[model samples]
Target: MIDDFLDGSLPAVEEAVRKAAAAEIMPRWRQLATHEIVEKSGPHDLVTVADRLAEAHLTVSLTALLPGSVVVGEESVHADPAVYAALRGDAPVWIVDPVDGTRQFVRGEPGFCTLVALAVRGEVLASWTFAPALDEMAVAVRGRGARLNGTAIRAGSPARGAVLKVAMSHPDYTTPEEKAALLCLDTEGVEARPCGSAGLEYLAVARGALDAVAFSWEYAWDHAAGLLLVEEAGGAHATLAGVPFRVTGANVLPFTAARDQATATRIRTLLTAP
Candidate 1:
C-alpha cells in the first residue's frame, strides 16, 4: 500500500502540504497575535497557532490520502508523547514538522518551512519540504532521487581543499556533552554556524547550497524529511559511532548529513576526536 502510494501519488502529498501551508501557515506569517504564540520548552522553543493548525490540517488531509496511515507530528507529540510510538509500529507513519522555524516565522523572517515524510518501521520512503514564503517545494522518494520546484537537484561534493560549510545545532538545544562534540567543527577546514530551520538546512545540503548539517538532536519530525532528501540527492549522513543515522532513536549525538560519504566520514571523525 505504501509503495503504491509512493509510486504514483507523490504529487497528491505535495499538494496536501502546499494546501496546509497556504490555509494554515502562510496566512499567519507576519500576522501572528500576541496570544497566538507561546513557548513550549523555553524562549528558544516556540509553538504558535499556525504550527498547531497546520499540523492538524496535514494530519487530516494526509491520513485521508492514505487510509490506515498514522502521523507523528511535532505538535501532536507535544500534546501526547505516546503518539510518537507510531514511528516504530507496523502502520505507515507520516512524520511532520508543520512550522520548522517558529522563531523565524514569529519574527517575520522567511526562513521557515513545512516538513513531511512518510516512514514505515523506521525507514523513510518519501518526503516533502515546502517553504511557502520562499516559493520552494522539495520532494524526495527513496531510490528515485530528489527534486526542488519540479527540477532534480544533487548534493555535489565540496571542492577539493575547500572549507566544508556546515550548519550545526544551536548551543541552546544541545547538552554539555553534545556541545563538546559540535565544538569540534571549529577546527580548520570547516566553517560552522548555528542552524536556522532544520528542514531548510537539510534542503541546503540536498541541493548543494550548503555542504553539510550537524545536528545534536534526533526528533523524527525534524530530521526525517531532510535526511531522505539528502540521501536521495547523493548525500550521506553519519553519527559519532561511524554509522548511518537511525530515525528510530539511540543514535550517537552530533550526527552529520554531508554531501557525500567521505565528507560524512570526516565530520564523524571530527565529532569523535578527543
Candidate 2:
C-alpha cells in the first residue's frame, strides 16, 4: 500500500483534497450565510458548514482510495475523540484537517487551507496542503522531497550573524508562560511576530519565505501535513526537548520548525532562554 501510494495513489489523495475543497469549501468561501458558521468553543474557535462537510467528504474518499485505511479527521474526532487513536494504530491513517484556518475562512480571508496526511504508527508518509483560495498546493512524500505547485523547493538557509525572522504564536492562544517564552524572540538580532494559518506558516518555512515558526500547540491535524512538508523540504522540527516532532497528537508545546536543524536548535534555545 505504501509503495502504491508513493508510485501513483498520491495523486488520487491530492485530487480528493482538491475536490473536497472545491465542492464543500471554496463555494462557501465568501458566500456563507450566518447560519452556516458556528462557534465551536469560543468566538475565535469557529466551525462552519464547510469544515464539517469537507471533512466528511474527505473521510469517505480517502478511505475508499486506500481500503482498510482509517481516517482521523478533525470533525470526526471532535464528535468522537476516540477517532484520533488511529494515529497510533498500525493501519494507514488519513489525518484530515478540512479547513486548517477556520478562523480565517469564517472571516472570508484567503489564509485557510485543507490539510491531509497519510500516516502509519505516527510516521507521516505523504501530505497535501491545498490553499484553495490562494490557489497553491504543496505536496511532500517522505523520501522524495517536497513540491509547491509542481516545482521543487527547499527551506531557507540559516542566517549567518543576521537577525532571524521568526513567526511566534499569538499571545491570545497561548499561556502566559508560553507567551513570555515566545517574546524572547524580540530580543536583539531577531524579528518576531504572530503568524497566520499554521499551514501557510509551515509552507513559508519550506519555501524559504520565512526563517522559522514557533507554535504553542501540537494538534495532529494542524501540524501533520506541515511537518512532513518542512522535513521533506530539508527543514527540521523539534520539541524544546530536542527531539523530532511527533504526530500522535501528544507532544510538548512551544515547538519550533525551522529551515534547518541548526536554526531549530537556536530558536529552541532562545525560546527557552532565561
Best by lDDT: 1
Q: List the residue pairs that clash in candidate 2.
A: none
TM-score of 1: 0.99
lDDT of each: 0.94, 0.90
Q: Which candidate number would show the highest TM-score if scored against the true structure?
A: 1
Runs off by more than 4 Å, candidate 2: none
Estimate the overall C-alpha local distance difference test score of candidate 2.
0.90
Flag regions of model 1 displaced more than 4 Å: none
Error of 1 at 190 (Å): 0.8
For candidate 1, lDDT tens digit of each residue in 33-114? 9999999899999999999999999999999999999999999999999998888999999999999989999999999999
